[model samples]
Target chain A: MAFDAFQKRKERQLLWLLLPALVPLLILTIYPALYAVYLSMTNEALTGVAAAKPRFVGAANYLRLFSDGRFWNSLFVTFVFVVGSAIIGQFVLGFISAMALRRKIVGAPVFGAAILLPNAAPEVVAGFMWISMLAGGDHATLSKILVFFGLPYVDWLQTFPLFMVVMVNTWRGIGTAMILLTAGLAAVPAEVYEAARMDGANPRQMFMRITLPLMAPTIFLYMLISTVSTISVFGLVYALTRGGPGNKTEVISVYIYNQSFAAFQIGYGAAGAVVALVVSLALGIAYVRSLKVEV
Target chain B: MAGISEKRSGAYTLLAYVTLIVISIFCVLPFVWMALASIDSNVQLFLKWPDSVTFDHYTKVFAEENGVRWFANSLFTVLSATFIVMVVAGLGGYALSRSKAWWKQPFLYAILLIRVLPSTALLVPLYKILLTANNGIGTVLRPLVGEHYRFVMQLFGFIDGYLGLIIVLATGQLPLALWIMKVFFDGVPKDYEEAAILDGATLVQRIRRVLIPLALPGLAAAGLFAFMSAWGDFLLPLILLSSPELQTLPIGLFRAFLRVNEIDYGLLAALATIYLIPAVIAFSFARRFLVQTFSGGVKG
Candidate 1:
């Protein structure tokens, strides 16, 4: 009975400890999220009559959003961005880098440092840095290099907005992918590799049969993180293209921002944001389910 | 047979080295070019190699543009947010780690779920809340403070101030910080605290003397991450703090790009370089701890 009373007291203390974190989270995260749902059903705006007196439209914004071609375009762009940058580019290059770093090569630290350095720059800073390199003109770094090679200088960003954005995001994200995959690589036991070698398994076969299967959970976790975060990437893409050159690079986040802040349609933007939320929640559930299966 | 295998292994090693070098160059080339552009004059930017380097662009960042103010604003907001996250996450993490409550598992999962939710989804509603608070607080304070109404209103204002941004950032980072700290706290043995309790050490005393010192590295790692996220953030500050005087580094750099007529490549490059310095320095200092945090997170 005395021990039970002590346990109850301890539970109360734990609740008290949680208050500091929970209060801010409730206000900042939970409240905003619930409010977003409410806002999505109204005809709110930052200006005009809608700003002065927003009325409940009851899914009108969502209905309009479903019909909007630009909304569809943003979703398509987001799909390509997530796949090109996070799934394919970062994973492939990052896995290779992780595998390379695992080897006892000369200058391995220097190579690791170089790969890690790009992540140090903030998104907008990295975006501007790339703008200098891939900016549309004869004077840009890529153009200058092409000119030196006796080739015509091409405006990279203008000619290929989505591709350039994807490439830049991949560059910024490879370090994170490499770090996570390296941890995964380390967890695979050396004795397993030795056994495979003794069984006359070639390197490629060993990797396919052993390392890839072992690293599946970690890879899924990385994908879950990178995909969700990449979907919300705003500053980098915005700073680079501003969803311009005819909205060719308007990912969902940018589309929402343009609608809310640029077009001043808060309700419409909230509806778009709701769609983004649902997509992310769906992706999160899928990844979590895969993780459970892997475990 | 051994000789043939050795020759093939040598070729494989050569291939690995070549690949590593090429990837490293691909990663580093943009920063090198940006640095070069920062030091070059407009005319020199077009040249293959500049004849001379100049600090003209660097000077212009401070002289014409208010770079110092933006840097200070960023420093203040990030540091304040980091401090809040450390305090809140530290307490909560200790509870989650040490407690045996049945609710802890579900609560922890909820926190993780909150972390995965895209922050952009909350932007519109957050904007509305801030706007409401701005008007509501003004009306509430007008009668209470009377003569000192503006000062009091600004203090409570959420729309365009440091307080709102700090709160939002701290909340956004709390989950990761809490998780990292919890992992560290779990690593610490219970024997020390048990012994302390036997000697009649108070809860605060046990925490301060025993738990904190052991978890210092974890705390530092979490604090560094929180600081970086806050410092590097563009969206929250962009929408929340609308005043020119309140601009952070990312916002400042963006404005410079937008506002400048000729798109002064040299000046923009210099500003970006300046913005990159603190993050690089922080990463270099905390690289080991940060990596350990990631590994710990993944293993769990």
Candidate 2:
């Protein structure tokens, strides 16, 4: 059992090495996640009587959350934000950008860097810049451009708050989508296109028959990752409109923030948090399973 | 490879060029406004050619505002967090790569699942946990530190302290760094370690001599990602630190922005640009690693 002893010692040493990383993640992430589920069933608060004498009220918070119109609004807004930006807006633009970049076009790198520059911006900074661009004035950056092109100036954000939010989110993330889709594109062998060309396939046919089918897996993974991340988006929504112009752009994260901190309803916020947690965890499990099977 | 190019009509090629240019403009316009406004003597919310360029806004951020303190707080905490991730993940990654224990697979999966847990969802209970820890630290330090209690707690207390922020930020970044390192070490040749073992190198000596040297590239990737992510984080600082002195750049910029009536675009832009530069620099270096990082963690 000398070899077994040696193996045992090695495993023990390795486990010790992982302890520092493990301890904090457990204390901060995992423990709190479980705590959130527990917190949801209670009537916790940051102030007043509930803060001092918090008591468990099983499913009361969830029942309230389910019936709350604002809660439903936040969920609906989140759905639109994810689908509009990550799913449709970023995907379509990113796909086009990626395809165009594949043409070995001039200034491809410049174009790529230009697209990615926004991704480098912090959420507050991005929101700040967009506020300028979409401000309600004749001289706003976007409006000035519109005026130059014989279009009228309108407050982009106020006029279409949800759409503007979606657009800005799309602008910020197009680079990621482009990067991921570019990777996916590269995976499709050039020889397949060559063969398709020989068979009298046009660009459209090649894309539909060859590219789309082949890129499905990468596209799926990209969608899942982006969707989950998008669901968690708070800073951008907060910066642009603190869920304002009515409940127009109140994504779930922002709603949770407004509820927990602004409204001082910690227990109710935990209910929302738990729902988000469950949804994200389910998607994450699917992502992990896909990674295992594919990679 | 060039078959598609030949098949693509001249008109289509022209279309591609146009598409790239337009998209690039859309992407870069906001940044253009921010950069120009930051320096313009008379700034506007709208994009315009600067009438006269001045560095006054930048200087004012440091001199008139709490920019220096905020920048320093952000830099210190984020850099410390990045360093912590690099070290912790380096060791843990090596272990995960080498270990045949029953927990290894579960641990890897756990970290990935952790990545998916939205930070907002965790924020509520995380606040509570930090509060409890902050109280415990207060109890231990209150009598001991006496008059220096405030200053001491600023560094050590969990709720609003440097130590708490650094550790929490580091912990937030650990899953990815660990995943990166584990995958990185899996690719590293085991012969070096085996050779070091044959040379009668003890475990510590082996790690110091072999693993650390070999893990540098992986550690750099881990650290850079950690820096970029932590630098961009808004929620952590916004939630955890309540004191003005403890406010990081994002919070600082955000609060400055909230002064609606007298909102100084020039000063805010300057602060944002200053805040953004390091992240952009880190991101530029981290660019090549992106494909690898996404296509399953540096696996060739």
Candidate 3:
């Protein structure tokens, strides 16, 4: 009876302890999310009459969203951004960096530090830095480099806004992918490689047969985390392009921001937000179920 | 492993070095330009060797602009948010690690799911909620303080105030910090707490005396991450603070860039360099904890 009483008391204490975190989350994250759904169904505006008296329009905003070409363009841009940066660019470059670092090479730490530096850069700084690197017609860094090699200067951002955005996003994330994949690489036992070598397997064959299969779980985790994060990337792309040169670089987050604030269409933006939220939540659920996380 | 030919191995090692050098250059090139531009007297958009290295641009940021205010604002809000995250996550994480209640598992899953919900999606409604709270607080404060209303509201109001930004930033970071501290506390044996309890120590006493000392590393990890993330945040400050007095470094740098007619490359780079320093310092310190946190995040 006493033990039961002690256990009960402890739990009550814990509930009190949890209240500080719980309250803000309830008001800010949970409430706002639910409110987003409610707000999406209404003809809400940031200012003017709709702000004063929001009216429920049911599926009207969503119908409008389904037909919107810019909305479709943003989705396509986001898909390309996630896949191009997180899946392809960062992964390949990071994996190569990781692999090279494992070879008992000289100056490995310097290489590692140099690569990780970009991850530490704030999005705004990274965007501003890239503008200097890309925007200065004849005086841009890339143009200067091209001139040194006697090649024509290409107006990078204006000519290929989406690609430049992807590359910059890729640059920011390569460090994260490298660090995670490095941990994954370390976990694959040296004994496996030794056994493969005994069978006269080349490095390529050994990696395909041994490393790739062994690192599947880590790779999957990296993919899920990176994809979700890359989708959420805003300040970098926003500061870089502002979804412009004709909305060519508009990812979903920027799209939502532009629709809501720039266009003053809160209800319309919320509908797009709902779509993003659902997509992310679905992926998150899959991640949880797949990992069957220990917590 | 010795079954491999030595000649082939040499080539591969050389290839590895070449790859590393190239990738490292690609990664660090932009930063190099930013640094050089900050010091270059004749700085332009492109990378170039300085004809005469100068400190004038950096001084211009402080003497001519609001560099000090921007830096202080960024530091103050981010630090306050980090502190709140540490304290809240510390207590809540202990509860999570030790408790076997039914709510534990559901709560855990909810926070993990919360991690994936992008902040942009919630911005509109979040704005609405803050607006309502701001009005409520304004109503309550306007009559009480009379003439000092605006000043007090700037400090305490929910919409364009210090308190609102600090609380919201901390909350956005809570899920990860909670996970971090929970995982950390799980590894900590409960014997010290048990002993403290047997000595008739109250919960608060036990936490202050026993748990805090043991949870320092966990707290450091949580705090570092919270600081880095909150420091780097742009959207929250952008939407939250409209007043020039409240501008953070990111906004200040952004605004400096937005002066289309009078663009000063040197000063902008200096501002960026100043902004970049703290993040780099924090990141370097946080480096050792990265592998553990990322793997712990998923494995937990």
Every candidate's CA RMSD: 2.5, 2.1, 1.4
TM-scores vs. true structure, each candidate: 0.95, 0.98, 0.98
Pairs that collide, model 2: none
Ranking by lDDT: 3, 2, 1
Docking class of 1: medium
State the C-alpha lDDT per candidate.
Answer: 0.83, 0.91, 0.92
Please, what are the lDDT tens digits per residue for candidate 1 over residues A46-137? 89999989999998999999999999999999999999999998889889999988877998989988988887888898888888788759
Q: How high is the lDDT of residue B122 in model 3?
A: 94
Which pairs clash (backbone N, Cα, C closer than 3 Å) in model 1?
none
Per-residue lDDT of candidate 2, residues B1-300 (tens digit): 567566666667889999989999999999999999999999987888888999999999999999999999999999999999999999999999999898988888898889889899999999999999999989999999999999999999898999999999999999889988988998999999989988999889999999999999999999989999999999999999988989999999999999989899999999999999999999999888887777553111
Judging by lDDT, tell me the better candidate of 2 and 3.
3
Interface RMSD of 1: 3.0
In terms of lDDT, model 2 sits at: 0.91
User: Over the stretch A59-83, how does candidate 2's per-residue lDDT look in tens digits?
Assistant: 9999999999999999999999999
Better of 2 and 3 by DockQ: 3
Q: What's the true lDDT of residue B157 in model 2?
A: 88
lDDT of 3 at B215: 99
